[model samples]
Target: MQDALIVLVHGAGIGAVFALIGMSFNVVFNSSGILNFAQGNMLVLGGLFAFLVLPSSPGIGPWFVFLPASALLMAALLAVQGYLTLLPLRSSVEQHSWLITTLAASVIIGAVLLIFQGTAQQTVRSPFPSFWFLGTRVPAPYALSLLLALVWFGLLRWFHTRALTGLAISAIAQDLDAARAAGIRVHRLQILAFAISGLIVGSAGFVAAPVIAIANDSGVSYVLHGFVAAVIGGLGSDLGALVGGLLVGMISMYAAYTYGGEFQDAVSLALLVAVLMGRPEGLFGRPAARRV
Candidate 1:
């Protein structure tokens, strides 16, 4: 029973982070119809920024400062990447240039991080102490990550349903041509989506840094897992991303606990394959109607 509880807590924590990354993917995908492959690197960059800014034993005040600062910086950087990725093309969906541009941006970011941080994995010391949950020692960041996920989801939900700008963003996602035809400023909204996506992942990276090691090479793994989560939950569905992330996190934890750490990724991939085979649109995704 204790083992089960421990697994649940740990899974939820890491899963929350994955869900955030997935939602970030959905944000940009919705507005621009382009998947920013550099999202994972942006997440790592967020953690790197947090590592540089925060001290070994940071206080609450520092967190308040670091979170917004890291998020804003990432937002700006990703916005620029979005601009460059979209600049050479006439239409985002029509050109398919983003595939190369986004990947190149990711590689460039990884190279820069590698050059500066070296190949070693960097750990961020948690400001809060570990607490015992049942028989398991739970880290503070884990709980924090879960809380952040909840807050983020709520805010996003409200933004999409209530806010005027968010409604515009949603309109763009629904139909780019229609949104533009309605004078919604499609280009500006697309850039905003990129910025918002960066903010989501940046904050996630900062919060999850203590749990996941910060390393330049880890971006691929993060992106892969997050992408899986997004797909499993159904792309463009924020709630689905959360559900998918939690499911992935729990299953991976179970695999690790039962077999070994190495089997976690294998289990996740197998789950993805199973889901795709059964439902290509994802568990929560709606199927698009094709015109005959």
Candidate 2:
């Protein structure tokens, strides 16, 4: 009974973590139609920053420092990435080429992390990045992750709802040509979306580690889940991503527990296949037209 209960708890926690990762991926894809594989590097960046900055200066208590600091840095890096990488390409050829570019970038960043940190594996090296938040028996790292996700999600919601840039982003997603006609700044908005997407996934990697440490190659799963979640929920719909992420999260949790984590990846792919066959448009995504 005890072991089963533990498994259940762990599964739920892991599910939440995965959901966050999925949401991050969806944000960028929905707005720009670009699939970013370099997102995991953001995770690596967060880890390095958290490992270094969180412990410096006035020394804010563990709970007060790591989350915000990591998020801020992640957001900044993502912003830079979007400005430099996507901004130039926004006016260029087919967006599909971005997939290849980002994949290559991810490879480069991963290599840099290994070289600088001398870590051949993808592990969070922060010595004491978290601490007891409310005296709860649960590890501080887990609690921190939950809090960070909620806070970041809320902030993202506000940006998407109340900000001019956010609205413009939506316009681009609905129809880029129309958006351009309306003076929506399509290219710039896409770049912004790219940054936002990277920020979400990148910070997620950082917080996710303390709660559930990952291997170096674990980034592959992160990227893959983000892709799957985007499909399951439907392209360009944040709500859809959230719903799809949660659904997939539950499935992954149970599958990992029942069939071992190794098969969990296969199960997720299976879910994707089933979803495609049952609803080709995704749970909420619209179907693409077939032109003669």
Candidate 3:
């Protein structure tokens, strides 16, 4: 029972990170109809930033400063990337240019990280102390990651429902052409969405860095699992991302416990395949309608 509880906590913590990445994907996809593949790399970059800027032993004050600074920096960078990615095409959905553009951006970011950070896995000592939970020594970062996920989810929900700009962003997601016709600045909103995505994943990466291995190549795995979570939850649903992330996290953890660590990815892949076969639209995703 204690073992199970430990797995649960660890799974939820790591799952929260995946959920943040999934939410980032949804944000970009919704606003621009383009999946900013660079998002995963951006998360890695966030951790790298934390590694570079943060002291070996940081206190709560350092984290408070790090969070907003990381968000702003990521937002600016992603917004610029979004602009470049969207500049060549009139309609993002109609043209497939983003596939290449975003991927190229991702590659460039990864390359840069590799050049500077190298292949060694980096880990920072957590400023917060570990606590015992039901005979398990639980790390503080795990609980903090889960808390951040829930807080971000609530904040996003409020933004979508209450904020005018967020409502406009949602309008663009629903019908780009209609939103443009309604005088909404679609392109601007798309850029904002990318920035918002950066804010989400960037802060997440920083907070969760203590638990996860930070390395240049780690982006690929993070993105892959995050994409799986997003697909499982439905592409545009934030709530779905949360649920999917937790589900994926728990399943993978359980698989590791039962079959061994190597089987974690395999189990996640199997779950993804099952979801695709049984419900392609995802648990919370509505079927998209097309006018022929």
Candidate 4:
């Protein structure tokens, strides 16, 4: 029973991180129709920013101070990258230029980190102190990650329903041509999406620092994991991201416990393959319809 509880708590924390990554992917895709393969690296950038901004002793001050700072920095940096990636290709004939451009941006970020920070892994201490729960030791960071995920989800839902800019984003996602014809600024909204995505994912990385170690090349693997979660949840569905993240997180934790840590990736791959083969549109994704 204790083992089961442990897995549950552990899986919930992991799910929170995956959910954040998946939602960030969904935001960029919905706004710009671009997958922004650099999503994971953006999280890495957030951690690095927090590392640089905070004093060596992080728990000494109000941790909330660093949160917005990292988030805003991430928002600015990623918005610029999004602009460069999208603006020039506004009239390009090639439909998939984003594939190369986003990947290139990711590579550049990784290279920059390597050149300056070296290949060593950096740790970010959690601001919250540890606590005991259900007769188990639960790190404050893990619990905080879960709380933040819920809050972020609610905030996003409200933004989509009540905010004018959010409505514009939804309109664009539904039909870009119609939205533009209606006098909506498509490019600007897309850039805003990128900025918002950065803020969310950057904060996720920052809060998750205590649990996940940061390294220059860690972004690629995270991208894959997050991508899998997004696919499972349906690429553009925010609700799907939440459910899918939790599902994937639990699956990963269980697999690691039952078989071994080595089987974690293998299990995830198999699940992804099964989903693609059976329901390419994903569990929540709507099947694409075209005029005959």
Ranking by TM-score: 3, 1, 4, 2
TM-score list, all predictions: 0.97, 0.81, 0.97, 0.94
State the C-alpha lDDT per candidate.
0.88, 0.64, 0.88, 0.82
Q: Considering lDDT, which of the candidate structures 2 and 3 is the better prediction for this target?
A: 3
lDDT, candidate 2, 1-292, per-residue tens: 5545545455445555555666676677667666667765666566556555544332336635566667666777666666666645744325566766778777877776666766554334333344432332345445555555566667767887898887777667667677788988766666667667656665666666555434345566666776687678776555566667656766776788788989787898999999989997789787767448
Candidate 1 residue 134 C-alpha distance from true site, Å = 3.0
**Which residue runs of candidate 4 sit more than 4 Å off their true CA positions?**
91-94
Error of 4 at 129 (Å): 1.5
- lDDT for 140 in candidate 4 is 80
Residue-level lDDT of model 1, residues 1-292, one tens digit each, is 7888889889988888888888999889888889888888888888888889889888878988889888899999989988888888777867798999989998998899889999888878778888988788889988888888888888889988999999998998888888888999888888989999989998988988888868878888888888999999999989888899888998999899989999999999999999989999899988877558
Candidate 3 Cα errors over 4 Å, as ranges: none
Candidate 2 residue spans exceeding 4 A from truth = 1-5, 55-63, 87-93, 120-138, 212-216, 288-292
- What's the true lDDT of residue 228 in model 2? 80
Q: For every model in order, what is the number of clashing pairs? A: 0, 1, 0, 0
Judged by whole-model lDDT over C-alpha atoms, candidate 3 comes out at 0.88
